[model samples]
Target: MNQRPKLRSPPPSSAASSPSPPTSPNLNRDKAKTIIKMPRKSYIKPTLVLASLLTIFALYTFLFYTPPNYNNNSSNLLNLVNKFDTNNSNVNKVKIYMYDLPRRFTYGVIESYAAARGGGQVEKDALLKYPGNQHSAEWYLFSDLNRPSESRINSAVTRVMDPEDADLLYVPFFSSLSLVVNPIRSANANGPADRPTYNDEQMQEALMEWLEEQVYWKRNNGWDHVFICQDPNALYKVIDRVKNGVLLVSDFGRLGRNQASLVKDVILPYSHRINTYNGDIGVENRKSLLFFMGNRYRKEGGKIRDLLFQVLEKEMDVIIKHGTQSRESRRAATQGMHTSKFCLHPAGDTPSACRLFDAIVSLCIPVIVSDYIELPFEDVINYKNIAVFMDTTTAVKPGYLVKSLRRVSTERILELQKELKKVKRYFEYEDPNGTVKEIWRQVSSKLPLIKLMTNRDGLIRLQNSPQSCYKISLYIENLDYQEPATTYFGEKPRPAKLACTIISMS
Candidate 1:
């Protein structure tokens, strides 16, 4: 109570006593000065300012701007875009003029096969379908050429309707299929009078006859034409007739050095028969050390297959089977390749076969045994990285191949598997950038040489003389060409100047 009584109001300071009259003019003036001194509130926002500027600029552009005349500047625009756009550029494409051959040479062959196989009356679109065989490269190429231009925009070869604009001529004859479907007979063989059986020889003769009638074939003597004879015996009757053209082949095995050479021909990988392995590269799941499931007995360079079989059949951790190409056999082969560390790719009827591509797609390291083998796309693919090459002598030696494969470290096997996976797409025929495109690219690469040889056809004539015998030696080093043999010509030999080889006559 005493403390409360002691608490008294203190004297008011000047500010407290100066509670100025509310309506005073001086107070109002002071209030106005205080309000003016205070920092001004910013009504203008940065976002609003930017939006207003953009709107004005957009209006100005829409009112004043005009687009350039596309018709006048199209080529320049295309050049500029293509110069920058590497994906859709057609700079390296080869313009091809595919012959509109009679159906008897193309679809008729497939139709005959379908009838033979009990697949009656093939659909018009089903002409693209052919028997799944190593020789199907012809079918793939034909099918690719037949596709719409828009669909093949990125393809290495563009089908041009105008023959004058064509860089190369494509013969759409299904030579391989014709050989497979029709019976083999000598051209002079007799058949029933009522209905003469269509034979491979007759087909070959007919194809050559039709080809000879073509203006392009006559103009270039088939030097700029491309003929696919993948099978060893395909187009056998007319091999020499079409020798001047680019031969799409699996190998130079059955062909004579003069008929097909690496200089003028393109080697294509056989379409793989087995399912591709989709798993990552690893050794943990693979159980077998070596696997080979193909015909043990083969002819020519393929004789090594029998010898390798005799040696590898009894070896431990090896699965070598002499099996034909049945559905069950393919299944077995697929399983064997997928789980095997190394797949043996011994030569079959030819120096190379689909088995090598199968091994590649299966991600199985390939043990290539053919000495005379000329691989497809050798320019781009380094085979040594993904495959183990062995000469016939070394591979056939008992215990040599097995011992060598066993010596390969786990690290090395993994490396090979990785490389196989990387290159697997190149051998796949169905892939957009695979075998078909690569084959076209290979053909495109030969365009300059094809043009040069085509232009130089009748420019030079070498005559044989008794006084001075000129030896026209053309050597293709490291390829599977026969040794140079002397031929005493009664008259002048055809001009043998090739773009890829050095031809010298002395």
Candidate 2:
């Protein structure tokens, strides 16, 4: 009886229970239907990306702002290394070159070098870094028979650069050999300070300035020696146009030399030399002084030589080189002049021009021959600083030169010595490296000087001597002081534009 009751209920299977639930409807049961699920994010991906970023960041943090690597082989990477390997071998550590004025030109070069023990202190103008003494210069650079640069002259002037290396090269313009300085910045072309752009114009102007120095080496009578017998108060323009004329003691020489051309440019018509301010002059000493300048003057084919043999006694304790002296003698002359208390500075044909830097090198006060002569750096440097200016017009006249000597006293001489000592404290040599470093900075930054790249046509490649060179002054303006960690040479002041004027010399 328990089993029989179940047979009646089996009648509805759906085919038996409910029409078999349509096949489609069964597929839509939702529970048994597979859901389109999104894949889970990969933990390895985000973790791996973060790990890679951290590793890179850490490595970068350690390497970049560290000390610049020195190629171990080149301890002094700045200067050239000789292949004593061969005497004729020519290899430059610094591709760029520099040239300085001859040692005979500046006594300060030797004194400064000797004092610094070879460039240990700082220079005022900062045009040079090394002691800039000639001996220190030659020791490491010109040690080999051939003279050369001490460091590469960087085109981009930024921070101070190292000394350049060289053996020798010709600088046709100045007609002398000089040194070159270039500092290679691993990151910046202009080390730390930005440099100005230079063009052919700048190069040409610089060359012109260098060329003007030829007036020094040229013989005094080169242009037939035009002398101006001028009145102290006379107009300067009156004699500006005198080309090839000689001025004699007679006033007629001044009146006739510039006829029609420079004849009447004077704002004032008269000349006088009676300054009441200057006090009494010693008669004997004045006469003696005039005799030293010129005992007799005679025109020899438009040239004049002082016939002062009787009075040309060597009183300066220095030697003189008259275009005919040995190299050693010439060097000695420079050193001698530097040691003297006063050096004669007979002005050239012109009245007040700027060629006095030469006189400064010797630490000797310039005993100027021209009253009209004015110094360029008159303020920063006092005439009283290192000079004994005399009026040439007054000295040239009757008994006037003698009177000038009377004005000078032992106290004045002592004062000159004090000033000379102060001057000696500073080193004044044409610092080729320092100047070029400045040039490099300018060229690297500005847009205009793109044309004048480092072309070594006139560069002198020489043997390298190991020595520290320049310490450049870095000028940073409006700099943010945050983190002083990252170094940067901001934009530099543009260099004065080079203006080229070609004067075809005949």
Candidate 3:
């Protein structure tokens, strides 16, 4: 009878309590077991998981990945692995190896030069905004190289990164990339500027209009040509002339310079407006303030760095002595130019050394050491309005600095302040600053809605054109060592031009 008491359906839908169907039997049975298991486990699962994730992150960052402070905008452009873990990113950043500076230097040099120049050590957040000039997607700047006693800026087109595409090797600095856009197709390729080359996206577009591949080089490998900064008359008087294409000048205002017809103009106005609209190619919102302070060194130019370091050490000592500086200073004392009033430049290097831009960003007086600066054609329009240039090569004296500093009085400083106020307007709203922006604004605006070098497809497309194929190959060549200028860029580059036809099917 007990074995036959199984498998019975006892309850009816509306019947009152015919049988509870053993519902309470299960509830009663689980209560005892639930009490025992509940005490066995703690409820810190979320907290423990969070803690584990944090520890893993910390371990990975310290041992495997490097985090960066985005304060320095230029740091973003540098191909620095330690600062930026770009090893896994999808962008092409320039990796600059500084071989221009002296070896075995002072600690303050990093601060005085990098920090004082940009006004800070560079917070990682600010860098995300800047990325870099239009040349590349990312930048990794380094200071570990065999610097020369007397440094030189050598720009060479060689294959360093892509073996397939050539790159530009800027000696004393690091490596660089080229973006192809509207080809500046030239019938004759004579001068270096006229040749198929690109500094930013805009210049790339301008070059595409006139495409010519004639690589000419008495072209020794190292720093072959110096961008001599001087009056237009002196510049045109000494050399051969190429009428077809444009010249690459330093100062944007040089485009605005009033030169005699007898005198050859240093830079073209179109050149200055080109870089203005190149997006990230414009000035940084936040930057490091680097102040290059030192005695004049035209004669011994050899110990310029030594003297600079000596001066910096003394200056830093004074600051720390008065508690203004510190022995524990991790960064340059660069808050002085917080809102754009800082800059640092090389005593002698290129016409517009890093200082010119540093001062431009800080909105400080550039304090030029050499008068021979042949600023690119139209640099002055904006450069002159911003930077401070002190001719150390000619007026070498502290009194000059004193007078110049004094001249930056409430009125002159106010003038600079007025101009500095327009910095954002110039960048976003468009000013005479953008070299490429203006051109795109001018010609490209009226044309079809086609992407320029700013678009990856547009850039890659340039690599396929029969003419641009080789030029692009040269422009992209940066695997290792230096690539010859003539082979990649091509020979017979007497007259410069651009290569803008789309050839790559992919």
TM-score of each: 0.73, 0.28, 0.30
Q: Write down the worst ten-residue block by lDDT for model 2.
A: 267-276
Model 2 CA deviation exceeding 4 Å by range: 1-325, 328-340, 349-359, 371-376, 424-427, 430-506
TM-score computed on alpha carbons, candidate 2: 0.28
> Model 3 misses residue 7 by how many Å?
99
What is the alpha-carbon lDDT for the whole of candidate 3? 0.33
Model 2 lDDT per residue over 1-506, tens place: 45554444435444444454446766666635455454566799889999999999999989885766678547654344332313423332212222344442233333333332323333542343433222132222222112332233222311212213321121211111112122223564333243322232333344435534644212221122222222321222323322222221112323443341222111111111111112121222221222112113334211112412222334232222243224564454454444444455554333431123334444445566654433322223466656766554443455443345546776776676466545432223124433223322222332221112111111211111111111111222234445332322233333211011111111
- Most accurate candidate by TM-score: 1
Error of 3 at 281 (Å): 23
Stretches of candidate 3 off by over 4 Å are 1-244, 249-290, 293-336, 339-348, 376-385, 393-395, 398-400, 403-407, 423-435, 439-506
- lDDT (Cα, tens digit) per residue for candidate 1, span 273-354: 9998999999998999999998888787778888887888899999999999899999999999999999998888778888
Candidate 3 lDDT, 1-506, residue by residue in tens: 45665687867577564654656777878997888777555669988999999999988888987566676655655646533433333234222222222311212222233332233544442232221332221121121112231121111111134312322222221112222221334788444442333233332222222212213111211111112222222233222322211122333222343321112223312111111211222224423223443223423332344443444334321211111123232123233233223333444422443334433434544445454454432332566665566554433342343344544545665576456555533222123234223322222121121122124444545454567656655564643536343322333332112344332211
